[model samples]
Target chain A: MKTCYNCNRLNKDNDRYCRYCGKAIRNNSYYTGLKIGIVLGTLGIIIMLILYAIMYL
Target chain B: MKCIKCGAELEDVDNFCPECGELTAKGHRFFHDPSNLDILNNGKAVKLKKKFNAIISIFSLSVIIFALLMIFTGQNLMTPFGVIQKKINYYRYGYNTSLIKTNNKYNFKVNNYDEAIEFIKKDFSNQLYTCNQNKELTMLEYELESDYEIPSVVFCDMSLEEAHKIKDVIVRMYALFPNIKGNLTNITITNSKTGSDYVAYFQPAYQFVNVNKDIKENNKVNKTQILLNSYYFLNDNILSQDINEVLNNYYVEDATFESTIAHELGHYISFVAFLREKGVSNITLVTKDNEEEIKSLINEFENGEYLKNILEQALNNYNLKYNENLNLQSFAETISKYAGVKDKNGNLLYSETIAEAIHDYYLHNENAKKSSYEIVMVLKSKLKEVF
Candidate 1:
C-alpha cells in the first residue's frame, strides 16, 4: 500500500497514481529520477567549484 | 633613320648614314618599322596618341579612386616602421630597430638559468589546471583551448639549453621595462593549444589567486604571470640566434619567441596601466587592509565601467575613422585578424585587441596600426603617464 501526499489517500502499492486524488505515488521510477537529479546536481556543483578554484587558486 | 650631323646614303632601317653621314628625312622615324608607314599615312598615329592618352587617363582615375578608398578605409600610406623611421631617423644608424633587443642588459631577479627553473617550479605547478585537451604535442603536447575562465597552465620539461633561451628572453623582457621590477613573474612554458587565443598571454594577479579571502597569511604581492607555448622553442621554428632579429623580424607563418613574449608583456603593461588608472598603488601588496577594496576593484575593472569605457572610446574612434557603423567585434576584426578573439557572448575581447595593437606598434606593422591608431594612442598615453 502507498499513500498519496497530495490527497492523503491510500492506494495499492503497484498503482502509479492515487485512485481518489489522481496524484502520483512515489515509485521506483520516481526514486530513480530523484537519484539522477541529485547526482547531476551534485556533479554540476562540483564542476563549478573546481572551475572556481582553478580560476582563483 | 640617319644622323643629323653626318648622314650620306641611309637605309630605311638605319639610324646613321652609311656613307657621308648626312641627315635623311626617312630617318625621322628612328626605330619604327618601314612597313608601319601605312598606319602613319592613314592618320592612325594621332589616333594612337589619343588611345594612349585615354589609357593614361583611365589609369590615373583608377589610381585616384584606389587612393580615396584606402584613405576612407583607414589604410595609411605610412606603416608604423615608416612613421618611426621618419621620427627617429632610424634608417641612418643601420642598427637593429627592435626596442627591446637594443636596450636589453641581461638583468634578472633570478641569478642563473637553473635558478629561474627552480623559481618557476616553486611558484607554479606542473599540473595543467584548465588545459583539458589530449592532443599529442610535438615536443610537449598541449590540448586545452579554454578562454580566461580557467587558468590554462602548461608545465613543459625544459632542457638546460631551452631554459637558457627562456632565461635570455626573460632578461631582455625585464630590461625592456625596468619600472616593472616586481610586476612580471611566474613565466611557465606551456604547450596549451591556442585556437582563438594568442599563443602567449599575460594573466593578471586576481586570476592566479583568490583575492576575496581574509588576508591573514597570503599577503604576498602577486604579479602577472606570463604563459608561453613551447612550440616557439622548437628547433625548426627558430628564426635566428640573435634576439634582436627574433624581436624585430615579422614572419608570415610562425610567431617568433621574442615577439610573442613582447606581446604578452604588452598585456602586462596595459593591465598595469589600468591598475594605475583606477588609483591602485604598490600593486604587489595584498594586505587585509585593502583586500576587499582590491577584490571589488578587480571585479569592476574586469566586468564593470572601466572596461566599458575603453571599448566605447575605441569603437567610437574606429567607426568615425572608417565611416561605418560597426560593433566591437567587427571593429576588432577590422583592426587586425588576431585582435578579433571573441568573448563568451561573441563580443570581441578589448584587451586582446589592445595587446595586438601594442604588438603592431612594437613591430611597426603599418596596416594594423592605421586602423588601430586610436587604441595605440591610448596605449602610448598609458605607457607614458602610468609607467
Candidate 2:
C-alpha cells in the first residue's frame, strides 16, 4: 500500500498514481541514464588517445 | 506523510485526505532529499548531459585528427597557427626569412637572394654611396649578395648613420684585397652597448659554395666564406690615436681604419692560400687531429722567424711606454703575438700575426724588414698562383 501525501488517501502498493490525485511516480531512470553516459564518455576518450598515439607518435 | 491542504496526519497507505477529501498520493512528491530532483527532472537532465558529452567528444576527436595530420605531414605542431608555412620556409631555404627575428624586433625576408641584396641596398642607399664614391680612399668595393646563407651585415645597438660608416669600412677592406672578396661572404656590425664579446670575428659558411662545380672541378666538397666584424669602427678616433702612440708613427698613410680592415683581410687571404696549398676546400673538415699537420705546413710559409722577430720588436717598443687605460697592448698583440700563446681572454694570440705582418708589409713597403717583406711578397705571389 502507498499513501498520497496531497490528500491522505491510501492506495494499492503497486499503483503508480494516488487514487485521489494524479502524479507520475519517481523511478531510477535518471541514475541509469547518468551511469551509461559516464561509461560511454570514458570509452570515447580512451579510444581517441589510442588513435592519437598511433597516428601522431 | 502529512497532508499539505488540511494539516492531517496520514498513514503510508492513504491516497486522499480522510477529513477533507483532498488527494495526496497523486500530487508531486515533496523533495525531502536533493537527489529526488534528478528523478523529477530526469528527461531534461539526461538530454542536457548527453548534449554536453557530445560536445566534448567532438572536440577531442578534432584534436586527435589535427595531431595525426601534423605528424604525417612533418609539420611543426607548436608553430603559431598562421605562420606554420613560414617556419617551413626557414628550414627549406637556410636563409633569412620574415619568420626570423632580428634584434628581437624587426622581421625581414625576401623572395630570393637577389631581392635580399636589393632590400639591403635600398635601405642603406646613402651609406652605400658614401662607401662607393670614396672607394679609392677606403679601398673597399661593396659586394652585397643575397645568394649566401646569411645576411651580409647584422647591426645591433647601431643607428643607420653608424651602419653607413661601417659599410664604408667594409668597402675599403674589399678594395684593398680584391682577391679575398670571392672567399668573403658577410660582415656583422655591433656596438659596445650590445656587449659583443668577440669584438670581431669570421664565421665560415657551412654549405659548399658552387656545390656542383666544386665537386667536379676540385673534387672537394665545401669552401669557407670569410666574415668580418665591425666593432673596430665604433671608436675610430681613439683607436687611431692608440695605434699612432703605440707604433710611434705619425697619423700619415700608415695604420688607420685601412690598416685594421687590411689586417682582417690578410687573415682571409692566408686561409685561402692554406686551403689551396692543401688541395682542400672545407676548413671544418680539417679537425684538430689533422690541424697540427696543416698548421705546421701553413706556418712554414706564414710564421717565419723574420716576421715573428719584427712583430716582437714592434710590441716591445709599444710595451716600453704602455698606457694603463688603453688596450693598445691587446690590439697590437692581435696583430703580432707569437704563435701558440693565449691572450688574457684565453684566445689564441698569434693567429693574426701573419695577417698583421701582411698589413705592415703593405703599409711600410720597402721600409718593412727584409724577412717580413719577403714573406708578404711570397704570400701575394702564392695567392696569385692559387686563386
Candidate 3:
C-alpha cells in the first residue's frame, strides 16, 4: 500500500492515485527501510555490548 | 474533519469537500502510525510487513543463539580476536589462588618457564615408592573439586608440592592441547599409593557421547566432537618412579605422568576423530537416534583394520631397521604394555596403539618415535586434519 502525502490516506499498491483523496500515492518503502535500519542498529549495539563483556569482564 | 484549503465540515466517508470540492482526509489517522494503514492491494502491504518482521526476528534470534553458543562452549566462534583471547585464557588457567599458595609454600625460586618446569620436576623426582614397588599400599580417594561443573582433582593427602606438580601438568597439558581442555574431566588423583597398576586411565563415557542436550538446545548442525564426562584417574605414585623406571615398565621412554595424561587425552581425541571420519557429525546427535548404529561403528573403528594396518606397517618398519623378529603382539608390547591390550574378542584395541604413539610424540620419546615413526606421524596428521 502507498500513502498519499497530501491527504494521508492509504491507497492500493498498483494505483498511482489515491482511491479516496485522488492524490498521487508515492511508494513508502523508504519508511520500511528506516524501520529495518532501526531494528538492526539496535541489534548491533546489543551484540557489541555482549562482546565487550566476554572479552574484558 | 475539516479541509485544509477551506473551512468546510466533511463527513468521515466523504472523499471531497462539499463547498470547495477540495480533497478530504477520508478519516485517515496519522501517516507515521503503521497501525493506521488500511489493508489495501489484497493485503500485500501486510504481507510485506510480515516479511520485514520475520527477517528482523530471524536475524535477532540468530545473533542471540550465536552468543549463547560462544558463552557455553567458551569459544569465540573464530572471530578475528578469538585466537588472541584463547592465548590469553591458555596462560590464565594455572594462575589461580591454589597455584599461588603452592609457589609460596615451596619457594620455587622460579624465574622462567624452564625454571618452573625444573621446580616441578624436582617436586616429582626421587620420591617415596616406585610404581612397581608399591605393594599393599592404601588407596585413599580424594574429594573432587568442580570447575564449570566438571569434576576436577583435589589433592587431599598430597604435599602442596606434589599437588602443584600435577597442577603444572594440567596447566601444561591445556597449554599444549587447548581442545582437550573441558573434555578431560573427573580427574581423581589417588593419594600417594599405587593402588592400581596403571599410571592413569581414561574411562570413556560412551553414554555421555550420545546425550545431546547441548547440541539439541543450541541446534548446532556442524560436525563437531564432544567427549563429555570422561573419567581420568591419576595414581600419584607414578610420579615417585624415576623416568627410567617409567620407561622400563611402560616401554615408552621418558613417559612421565604428564605423558600418561596426554595418552588418556589422546584416547578422547582419537575417538572423536574416528567418529568424524566415519561420517558421524556430532557424537551426541548420532547416538541420540542411531544408538545401535553408533555403537557398531565405534566397535568397528576400535577393532578396525585402519589402525591395524598402521601398526603392522610400523612394526614392519621397526623390524626392518633393528633386524628384530617381532610380530604385532610383541611389537605392541614393545611400544607399551597398554598398546598390546586386547578386547573381549581378543582383537587388538588399536586405540591404545594410537594413544601410545601420541604419548611418545607428546614426550618427544626418541626411541619410541624412531621405532614407531609411522604410527606417530599418522596420529600427528590425524590431529592436524581434524583440529
In angstroms, how far off is A43's CA in candidate 3? 63
Model 3: docking quality category: incorrect
Query: In terms of TM-score, which candidate is stronger, 2 or 3?
Result: 3
lDDT by residue for model 2 (B42-144), tens: 5444454666578567757767777677656654454223233433643664421222121211123333335534443344332232121223322222334
> How many angstroms is residue B339 displaced in model 2 relative to the true structure, after the best TM-score fit?
10
Model 1, range B1-387, lDDT digits (tens) per residue? 334654333345432343333324554454266664443333322343344455555555654654565356443422222334323633553221211110112222433324443433344432332222222331232222121111222433334355444445445545544444444445555444332133466767632233334456544345457765544442323424543355443321233455666667667766766777766753445556776787776666566355446666877877788787887777666655667776788766677777666565555544445546667665556556766
Error of 3 at B155 (Å): 5.8
Q: Which candidate is the best by lDDT?
A: 3
Q: Give each candidate's interface RMSD in Å.
A: 48.0, 11.3, 8.7
The per-candidate TM-score of the B chain, in the order shown, comes to 0.47, 0.39, 0.44
Best candidate according to TM-score: 1
List candidate 2 stretches off by more than 4 Å: A1-57, B1-142, B146-151, B155-176, B190-199, B203-254, B284-350, B362-372
lDDT of 1: 0.49
Per-residue lDDT of candidate 3, residues B177-219 (tens digit): 4444333334543321222345555644333221344432321
